[model samples]
Target: MEENAISGDDNTHWFHSNGIITSIDNSQKKICVDISQKNSFFDGTNITLNCNKSSLDITYLEAGQEITFYFFENNVLDTEVAIEKLNIVTP
Candidate 1:
């Protein structure tokens, strides 16, 4: 099975959100993402997640970088792993 295909217990279901990074706080380990318009996976919502350590490092993340964040399973605070998942759609 794919890494992303892994499922978790209730209240721990993983969801992926895509948007330009609005702000980042490495000290507190948090990230703020906003999607102005709703899409298939998003609802024009601003998602704020508490980041944690991941298999990939995200220390160099900058604001305005297009990214898709994967919430860690079982953790209320989403973690930003330095995964190579850069998919952009230009319409």
Candidate 2:
């Protein structure tokens, strides 16, 4: 059984990282998550999660909160790299 993967436009990616909230851009509804710790995923970097793209209800997220989530690039005509969806796993 495969898990922790998000697919859009026939493209698939993994974002099964347990990260801590680093910052929140309420203006743009973007949340910066630091995946440097918790489960070993990626190169331990930070990724920005856009609320507009997320299906999960994270309107009450705060800095220092821990969560596991999946994220994927929007892949919009190569104009820019942005998040398509960021789903936070509910504990």
Question: Count of backbone clashes for each model?
Answer: 0, 0
Could you tell me every candidate's TM-score relative to the true structure?
Answer: 0.53, 0.54
Candidate 2's TM-score: 0.54
lDDT of 2 by residue, 1-91 (tens): 1235554443566444466778887778777777645343343357666566545456777888876655453332121224544444433
Where does candidate 2 stray beyond 4 Å? Answer: 1-14, 38-44, 54-56, 73-91
lDDT of 1 by residue, 36-76 (tens): 44544433466655555454354677777766655544443
Worst 10 residues of 1 by lDDT: 82-91
Error of 2 at 29 (Å): 1.2
Residue pairs of candidate 1 with colliding backbone atoms: none
RMSD of each: 6.6, 5.5
Could you tell me how far off, in angstroms, the CA of residue 15 lies in candidate 1 after the best superposition? 2.6
